[model samples]
Target: MRIARLGPRGAEVPVVLHDDRAHDLRGIAPDVDGAFLGGGGLDRVRDALAAGDLPELEGADALRIGAPIARPGAVYCIGMNYAAHAAESGSAPPERLVMFMKSPNTVQGPDDDVEIPRGSVKTDWEVELGVVIGTRTSYLRSPEDAWAHIAGYVVADDLSERDWQLAESGGQWSKGKSAPGFCPTGPWLVTPDEIDARAVRLRSRVNGDPRQDSSTADLVFGIDRILYELSQVLVLDPGDLVLTGTPEGVALSGRFPYLAAGDVVELEIDGLGRQRHRFVAHEDAPEVAGA
Candidate 1:
């Protein structure tokens, strides 16, 4: 099943997409959040749909599509998990995972405008496969155990400012990765039963021109291994987001120019859906509360 949220930012309504229509999920849960997922919300939603209890959500197509899940508690990212991406960044594929964190506040609607940080000159884009946690996970005994904790998958754009990430980070990448709206995610949260996750095509474009074109099958460390390795060091709770990493063809490869104001980025992963957003100058961008 495909789950989505649609409306103005911060006031979106949860819904299930089936038969090319949106079915209201307000009666089933408050929002498509951790409480809902960890509390058996999907099962309840399936039952309701089977019984014809969910009402059709009118005007859904005209509304903005918010990130499929509510604000995540944490946004974990894997860097250089793709061999080609590692080579592009001037590094050999790591024997261990290169992980980083993006503040949860970076989350934003899939189609929202992104701000180019003040005085920034190396802003870039990354198209990644995002995994959402459905249950509290810690110390799993095996990699296969990850399946039971996964809620679903979504498309994620891991926007970055390369200057701060490499030159001024003093060794930490989050400095460039944590800007507000740096993470634009989801047109839908597709359940595992509906996608292979291990072998889907993911691609990105800049101003309608192709940039990145790759597949999850190219990942050096697969989904199961990523989750299993993460569980050994930290706890991942429901609604937490894990970006499995982006493929090559980013500006960092020196093949394309970095993003500037007025540039549009489009990203898509087969089955999960697509996202498109524009970059605006910092002064012209909307003010983000508590940013």
Candidate 2:
């Protein structure tokens, strides 16, 4: 039930961790992903698994883990999906949910270090619960139908630049949010059968101190409604990701204390898992050879 994508960038393989051992679903059944997700291949893998025909993938600490889904077509995001977060940012709950997109290239492993872009300031963090779509959908009208298409969940951090987001660009939020490596995603893409997304505990700590602590219960739009809302405007595809949004304590939500160089930002969501990244200051990068 807990499937993992292990190995380094572009070399990852799907493996399921069962009973303290890593089951290499791909070993016995080469078509693991397609089969495991309820496709024709999925049924074949299931039948094989049921017959105890899969290979063992246990106890490999050296395996580098990648995001659960590879080649996610898009990374859609929600802003102020948390009621209190909206309030802290000096805004009212909108009549509708707010959305944005991060370049897919921004997606990286959950534990990857978040690099601070050169010539930038206002790097802030928003720890959010990520929803990955299992199938394509467009024009959905009800909340209940949303879950049927969701593949599972992952931990995502929407790193932002306040000034570039609000002031410098003259008001386009994506400019500040879409920087390369700005989005750190996944310890894994958990299937719903393994964890309860709604009951999860979410938290963010900066350099070992608690900052954003909340529950999925605090989300104003939640998953079902968010999918329905987004589907109404644009079509969502397999491997598309939705950021359910962050809760109350982001530095930009106005109490002002934003991130600086050398800060370590960490986020944890109950079953989905944890992610840590260091804030490297722009000035610290070595000067170019011909500068």
Candidate 3:
């Protein structure tokens, strides 16, 4: 089942897609936040959908999609999890995973235009695989247990700024990452049961040229281990998003080109769906408090 939240940004209603038609469940009982994939929610909805219990959505074409998960408790990211990406930045693979946070407010619809922050010139992009957690979890010993916590997956573009990340009064990498509207995710949430993730190919392009090209098979820390490692320190709650880390071919990687104003960004993953957004100059934004 492909689950999505569609409509206007703040007013998106939960709906499920089957047979290439949208279904509106305006008052059904399933909320995208939780219970959509847990406590027999998917089964009940799937049965209802198969039995024709759901009606078609009113306006599918014009609806803007919100990030699939409703209210994520946190947005956890893995840094330098891809070898070539680490090498591109002229560093060695870390002894352990490097984790950081991107405030949940940064979440936006997959197609939303990324606002370049004021007084910034080094805005950049990273295409990553985002894992949505289905259940609450803590420390686990092995990789197998990690799979139990994941609800599904979606494509995420982890936008960034190079100057704030390294050259500024940097304390943590999150400084550059937590800017408003920095994370664009989810045209659709593809459940793990419906797709194969082990060897899936992922790619991202800036404007028309391909900038990032790599396979999940190249990840330094695979999905299972990442969850197990993270669970040790923080409790993984339902609706929390875990970015699986971007593969090689980002501006930090140095081989690919950097993003600039008016450049279009496109991210695609097999089965999960594709999402596109454009980058704009910081100076083009409206004058505000800091301006």
Candidate 4:
């Protein structure tokens, strides 16, 4: 089953996407979040859908698409999980996983505009497969155990600013990663049973020019191993998002120029969905009160 949130930024309503139609999910739960997903929300949605009890969301096509799931409790990212991406970044594939975190506030709707941080150059884009946890997880015995804990998947854009990430940072990468709207995810959150997460195509284009094009099959550490390894370190609660990492062909490799104002970035993952965002200069963005 495919689930989504549609409406304005802060007032999104949950819905199920089936047969190319949007069915309102307000009757099932309040919003797509930890509380909903952890509390049998998917099962309820399936039952409702099968019973034809969900109403078609009127004018859904006109509504803005929000991140499929609400802001997660945390956003974890795997770095250089693709061997080729590792090589492009001037590093060798690590024997152990390299992980980082993005502030939950960075999450945004897939098609929202992205802001190039003020005084920044080297803002780059990365298209990755996102895994959303369905239940509280910790200390899993093996990779096979990860299956029961996964809720769904979404397409994630792991935008970055190389300066803050490498040149300025003491050693950490989150400084370059946690900017507002840095992580734009989803047009839909597809349930595990609906799609094969192990093998899929991920592609990205900037201003209509092709950039990153690769497949999840190339991941140095696959989802099952990633989840199992992650569980050994930190507790993953329901609704937590894990970005499995991006492929090669990013601007960071010096093969292309960094993002600039008015640039459009389009990313797609087969079976999940596609997202397109226009880049804007920080100064050109509307100022928020208290921000």
Best by lDDT: 1
After TM-score superposition, the amount by which residue 110's alpha carbon in candidate 2 deviates from its true location, in angstroms, is 0.9
Assess each prediction's global lDDT (C-alpha) against the native. Answer: 0.94, 0.76, 0.81, 0.93
**Candidate 4 accuracy as lDDT:** 0.93
Candidate 2 error regions (>4 Å): 27-48, 254-256, 282-291
What is the C-alpha lDDT profile of model 1 across 161-235, one tens digit per residue?
999999999999999998889999998999999999999999999999999999999999999999999999999
Q: Residue 237 of model 4: what lDDT?
A: 95
Residue 68 displacement in candidate 4 (angstroms)? 0.5
TM-score of each: 0.98, 0.88, 0.93, 0.98
Instruction: Extract clashing residue pairs from model 4.
Output: none
**Please, what are the lDDT tens digits per residue for candidate 3 over residues 5-100?**
887666787788888888876657545776555565666777888789899988786788777777677999999888888887788987798999
lDDT of 4 by residue, 1-291 (tens): 999999988889999999989999999898999999999999999999999999999999999899998989999999999999999999999799999999898889899888899988999999999999999999999999999999999999999999999999889999999988899999899999999999999999999999999899999999999999999999999999999999999999999999999999999999998999999999886542110
The global Cα lDDT (0 to 1) of model 3 is: 0.81
Ranked by TM-score, top first: 1, 4, 3, 2
> Could you tell me the C-alpha RMSD of candidate 3 in Å?
3.0
lDDT of 2 by residue, 121-211 (tens): 6788999999888777788868899988887788989888778887886656788888766778777677788788986899999999898
All predictions: root-mean-square deviation over Cα?
A: 1.2, 4.1, 3.0, 1.7
Q: What is the lDDT of residue 158 in candidate 1?
A: 94
